[model samples]
Structure formats: C-alpha cells, structure tokens
Target chain A: MSLLRILFVVLVAYPVVLIMLGINVRHRARLPRRGPAVIAANHNSHLDTLALLTLFPLHRIAQVRPVAAADYFLANRLIAWFSLNVIGIIPIRRKRERDGDDPLVACYAALERGEILLIFPEGSRGEPERMAQLKFGISFVAERYPRVPIVPVFMHGLGKSMPRGEWLPVPYFCDVFVGLPLKWRGDRESFMGELEQSFHKLKEKLAAPEYL
Target chain B: MTRLSLPPQVMYALLGAVALLIIASAVVLALARIRPERDYTELKLRIKTWWLIIIVFCLAIAFHRDVSLVVFAFVSFLAFKEYLSLIPTRRADHRVLFWAYLAIPVQYYWVGIEWYGMFIIFIPVFAFLYLPMKMVLIGETQGFLRAASTLHWGLMTTVFCLSHMAYLLALPDDRNPAGGGDALLFYLVFLTQINDVAQYVWGKSFGRHKATPTVSPNKTIEGLIGGVATTTLLAVALAPWLTPLTRIESVAAGVLIGMGGFIGDVTMSALKRDIGVKDSGTLLPGHGGILDRLDSLTYTAPLFFHFVYYLHY
Candidate 1:
C-alpha cells in the first residue's frame, strides 16, 4: 500500500470505524481469510463502501477493492485519484455511456489475484429502511467465477448516518452483518433471490426486539 | 506550582490506589488457585481493567495539567460519541449533530484558557440559541423540536456536564487550601466510584426492596442507604487530607455525591432502557462502555464543581 492509502486508512477509515460510525462487525468468521470471493452488500449511501473497506483487517485492505460508479468517482481529478489510488476502488459505468475499458475485467483481474471484490448488488443507493431489488451484476459475476463464494453483507443505519445528498454524516450506530457465504450451486435467478432473502433475514434479526 | 510539584493528596491517593491494586491482584490470584472450579474469571478481568485505568489516569494527572485536561477532553469526547451513537437520530439533524460534535473541543478550549464566563454560557446560551436556528434554515420541520431537544440534551449531559471536571482542574489554587484543584477532582472521582461500588455490593448482599424497579431494577432501598452511609463515612475520613471542607461540609459533599451519583447512574439506565439497549456500547472489556464508566462522573462532576466553587472559589 502507498503512503496516502495508509494515511487515509489511519485518518479516514479509523475515525469512521472507531469514532463516527461505531461500526460493529458481526459474524466476522464468515469473512473468508483468503479471498477469491464476491462481497455482495446492500447499498444505502456512499458511506457503504467506506464502511465495508474499513471493516477488513488493515493488512487485508490492500487486497480489497470496492466497485464504485464510474461516472461519479472518475469525473473529478482529485476524487478519481483518491478513489483509484487511495481507496483502490474499481469504477463500473452505470449508464454504460462511456466507451472505455470493461469494469468486469478489473474485477476479474482482482479475483484472479485471489483478492476480495466488494460489489453492492443493489447498484445504487436507496432508502435504508428497505432493500432495493438486486441487480443481475452479482449473478453475472457468480456464474463466471463459480468457485468463488458470494458473501452477503447486510448493513443497518448507514442511510440515516450519511443518506444520499447529505454532505455531513451523523454518527449513528451502524452494524454490519456478514451472512454465511453461498456457493454457486444454483441458477443465477435463484441465487439472486437467495442472496436478497439472506439480507432480509439479517435485517430482520438486527431489528429483532432483543435489546443490545 | 511547577509541573513537578503535585499536591501531596494527589500523590498519596495514587499510592493508595497502587497499594489497593496489589492487594486486589493477590486476592484474585488466590481465588483462582483456591476455587479453580468456580467461575471467578469476570472479577479477575475487572480487576485487571481497573489496574490499567488507574495507571493511565495517574500518569495523565502526574505528567502535567495540560495532559490531564487533554485526557479529560478525550474522555468527554468518547462519552459524547458513545452517547450520539446509542441514540436514534433523524436525517435532518446531521448538520446540527456536526455542530454538536464541534462543541466538544471548543468547550474544552474554554477550560484551557480559563474563560469561566464563556465556559459557563457557551453551550447553555449560544449553542442553545444557534443550533435550532441552523436547523430551521435547513427548512425541515417534521421532527424539528425532537431533533433539536435530543441534540441539546446530549450536549448538556455529555459535554456540558462532563466539562466541569476540566473546569474544576482550572480553578484558582488560592481558593483551595488543603490541596490544589487537582486533588479536588481526584477526591470527587474516587469517592463517586466508591459510592457506586458500595451500592452494588450492598445491593447484592443485603438489598431486597427495589428502589426504582422499572428504571433500574438492580438498585434497592437497602443498597442506597448502605452505600450512602458507607460513602459518607469514607468521605469524612478522607476530606481533611484531600479537600478544604470542614468535617460537616465533607459529610454534606459525600451525601451530594452519593445521591447525585445514583441519579446519574439511573438516568443513564433510563436512557438505555428507552433506547432498548442493555448496555451503552462495547468499548471496554468488562465494563459496558466509556459512557457506562463515566455515568456517575457526569452528575457528580458538575454538582461537586459548582458546590466547591460556590463555597470557596
């Protein structure tokens, strides 16, 4: 990792993890020690990526890359540099309007290197109180890399913390639930349904009446 | 006084704590060996944690006043952060919450500068008037009152109340005769924690009737009486060396701290109950969180600071 990445991890990541979000990662055993896996999470805000990135062990952060929207992340020079160099994110075009290198190829390359690929299957931010429909992107990746385990990550309170269009994030309590990883044993449609259901189950468990 | 010249009371108290820690460690070791079958592991962990906290606290105070102030500021920040994280906040309050977080350092800065006037009124007057106005400018009124009040209460308890400890240390030394301002803080913290531990032990040993069954079921009338009596006696014994208070005044201060400490602990309990959380957060190993540890200090610090300031300073 570069000096700036280390600085970002220390300054940005640790503060957001330890101070701001007070992020409690649950079922950490589900996180594969060695990865050629897809970390599929539900999206709520831009903070979702940062939360997941910081949740990984510092040594493993170098091997982790979040799939961010190309137009938003790659538009500005400073942000592009920070996102690409510091956070080490892979930008996939949302509208597919830009004629450039394929996003999936970058993801495949990371997977080929035994790195962990973080993808938000919802493809966009939504009201965190509810989950959005899962896109076929995860299914597409799972089919190609059938050997890779696709882990479903369910996050709560990121939407309230740094909801869409909000510059300053309130430090709300956030819990990231890492569910059991599923293998590519079923069809794409069935697998996507299963993944979405897994998130719902985790969300329900988190919202259960049991107090802290 | 220079950095090296600490009050005798503070030094003695630190030494006393070290002595107690050694005895406690020996007992824990003995318990482990004697009753290996029984689970005394939690007590052992709590004692270990206490050792760490005592060492860190003594080192901070012993180093310099600036270091102690910074350490207290960090404590207030942690308690404040934990408080904000535990509560349910609205989306519209994000900007206002940022302002609330900013108030921590600014409030502590007032202590560092010894600006008593600004320190007293900044949160109660200026922030109180300004935060709601900022929220109004955002043009969201759906839950405006709730959001504003929640943030304000959080500021009052976490930052405003806790900052009194820093302010206590900043008091003019001439007003303190027996010991300097640092000893006063140490006395208050040590006595308040003893009061808490006494209440728990008494409650477990002799308590039957619940004091506030719904709010804090663990607290009982028997425990309250026993704890307050024990703490008052301890306070009277230690006051001559640690504080400028006369014997009668020491008794009064002990009663204030014991009663106020109970109120603070129960107030936090009520908050946790309202929020549907068993503990504040998982910050410490044995203790629940910084908030959990400092709950009694929250009430006792401000009450004791004002009492001493009014009578002496």
Candidate 2:
C-alpha cells in the first residue's frame, strides 16, 4: 500500500472506531481541528502521541504525521503498525551520519499539503523535573509552511506512568494543555528557542497560572 | 361545571398575574447577588415589564385564541434583531439587510397562507438571489467581498432562518386540541433551554475531564451523557401531555430534540468562542439576551417543526 493512504487508515480511522466503542475520549483545545494546523507538544510520555491519535472525528484530516524517533519505532511490527497505519509516524533518523535518510523532507512535503503533523522538539525525553531544549524541527516545519499555526501542547504527568517501557501506564487523570497558536517568522534559530520556552511556560501555566 | 361559572375568565385573567409573579420570582432567584435596595427596585421594574408582556400574552390567548403563531413571530422578530446586532456586517449591504427584513413577513406569510413550498424556498433560494442583486444595484464597485457576506448573514440570521418560530405557531396537531399551538412553542423552548441546563448540571456533577477545554471548558462527557439522559426522560413525560405524542413517540421525539438542540448549542458556542464573547447580549436578564435564548431555537425550531410537519402532520 502507498505510504500516504496507509497513514490515513491508521491516524484517522482507527481511533474513531475506538471512540464509537466508548474508549473515554476527550478533546482538550477550543481550536478548530480544520485548516492548516501544527500540533507541537512536549515529548515526555507515549501518551503525548496517543492522545492526538483520538482527537479528530472528521475524515478530511486523515493524514497525521507524527515525528518519531528512529530508535523506538524502527523495526517492531506493533510500533510499525501504530506508526504506519494508526498514528502515521514519520521516522526521524538523528544519527547525523546516515546518508539518504531525509525525514525533514517528508515532513515539509506533508506540511505543504496542509496535513496535521505532530512534532515533539525536545529532541528526546528529558529528566522528570525539567523541560529539555526544543530541537529545530518545529521551526523547520513552520518555515516550510508559514501559513500554518504552530500550536503548543503540554502533557503533564504522563512520563511518570511507565516511562520507556514498563508495559502498561497506570491510570490517573492529568491535565492536558493546548495553548494558542503561534505564527512563525523567517528566523529559524530564534523560533526554536522561543518554542522551547513556550513549552516550559505551558507547564508552568498548567501547574498554577503565574498571573493568579 | 367550572365553565358554567364566570370564574374561568377571571381565572384566565389571574393567569397573567400568576405568570408575572413566577417570572419576577425566577429573575430574583437568578440575580441572587443583587443588594437588597437594588433588588426591591429591580423587582418592581421587572414586574412592570412582565406586566406588559403578560398582558399581551394573555390578551392574545383570551381574544384571538389561535394567534399563538403571531406571538412566536414577535419572539422571532426580537431574536432576529438580537442576532443581527451581534454579528458584524458590511455597511454597503443595506439593501440585502432590508430584503432580509422583508423576508421575516414573507416566511411567516407562507405559514399564514399555509404555502409550504414557497415558505421553504423563500429564504434559501429567493433571498440568496435577491440579496446579491440588491448589492449589485448600489454598485459600490470595490465592496463586493464585504457586500456578499453581509447580505448572506442578514438573510441567514434574520429572514430565512427565524420564520420557523412562526411556522411553530401552526403546531396544534389534528390529534389533540387541548395542548394548542402554544404547546409546540413551549416544547421547542423548554427542550432547547433544558438541554443547556442539563449539560451544565451533568458537567458539574460528574465531569472528570474536559471535552473541549480550550474552546469550551464546561463541556464534558459526563455532562453530555447526563444532559441527554435527563432531557430524554423529561421529553418522554412531557410530550404526551403537551403534544399528540405517546410515551414511546415522545421518547423518540425528545431524543431527536435533545441531540439536535445540543448540536445547535455547541455550534453557537463555538461561534461565540471564535469571536471571544460570553453572552450575545443582556436583552433578557438571567438568560443573557434574546440571541442567547434563540441560538438553539434557530436550528431547533425549523428542525422539529419540519419533522412533525412532514411525518406527523
């Protein structure tokens, strides 16, 4: 099957059928899931990815490309089925030495089509207390499709539940935060740094609003 | 036997007085935070205002007897005005808005004449054409973009849409006369409002998580389910006494209204969120405004009324 079509069946169809069966689904943001959208979030837990998998009901936004680590979902069928079919995982090879790997090129192409792409630019999961600096992937994708708004998301306390494979996540309700959409200017380095700070600010906002 | 006495007409006279008292008391309860001094004065003014409304309402009930639709038409007019005031429109499209105003009567006129075909087409097709032509006549030259949008919204908000409230005035079914046309009005109104109230109640009581926290924080699964459950039960019980519906039929009809009402409420809510406002206006105290009351009605009125008209009528 084609890469794009396979991704559609996975990201859009699977979770919808799950929701109809009553899987305790909830959508957090007030924003419209339509038009050019960027779902960028903190890369803490696997739930940061799974939560988005169930967000859309309308079939128009079928292809959701998750920027995934090559180390995690590279060769396993369970992960591969999730990546290719349900979640539409776009594998990012971070070796920096591997030739002909072009994951960023794939992401840019998806963005141009006005597809929903989930990117976590903390590079990798950080220590529990602190938010890691964001990678340039968000800015890179934003630059490619400047019309789309990069929406910042924060998933709290997800990493505490089975971080890096204990088989099952302990069930406890934690707040999910989706901030307002941010428009990207031409500057890449500054935008990346801003996005990093943006994610941290979201966490602070979730814990307790600074204004209050 | 009670009819033999002259007290019924007197009792009917007291119906207006009773309605006034209930409304005044309800408003007092809703604005429970008002200070005692302001409260008494507000209550007095409220009674006076409701006295006018209640007199008009009771007078229509007493005199015309079959003019419930006319009362609803007035309600629709108020609702349309509230909606038009809130929604932004281009100033160049005055002719379109004028035609939209013209549509209010034309649609109700169809109900008056019982011309279902013309009534249905009057807004969506005819108004659609007439509006653009009106815009083009002025020949602003550069304002076409704004002109087109304003004209369409005016029709949607004012004319093509609101006429359903008038259509509902014709709701007294052949099967039951006791309920009268006002029963349909009561059904549409209560169903819409209770759905909103029920959602809030359910959300507050059992809401473990947010459904659309960013767009609407109050919406939750617990609320949606609870509201539907409560409204469904209420609809089943109320529909039989109020309309020509049976126990099962009432359940089915209520389910339709409950779900349809929710969609209409959410759609209006999303629109408000997009515009970043709470209530449409303060036209009606404790209810926000006329548009706030009418949002669900706008979609619900036509929906249930048409459903009853085609299948049940």
Worst 10 residues of 1 chain B by lDDT: B279-288
Judged by DockQ cut-offs, the docking class of candidate 1 is acceptable
> Distance (Å) between predicted and true CA of B181, model 1?
1.3
TM-score of chain B in each prediction: 0.93, 0.75
Q: Pairs clashing in candidate 2?
A: A10-A85, A10-A86, A11-A86, A30-B214, A30-B215
TM accuracy, model 1: 0.91
lDDT of 1 by residue, A1-212 (tens): 45666678878878886666677778888987778888999898878888887777777777888888889889999999889999888888766555764557778888999989999988889765457888887787888888899899998777777888887776666778899988676589888888888988888667322111
Cα lDDT tens digits, model 2, A103-151, are 6876777766777778887877665324676677677677777778888
- Candidate 1 per-residue lDDT, tens place, B203-310, comes to 989999999999999899999999999989998998988888988889999999999999999999998898887766542222247787778888999999988888
lDDT of 2 by residue, B103-131 (tens): 77667778777677898888788877877
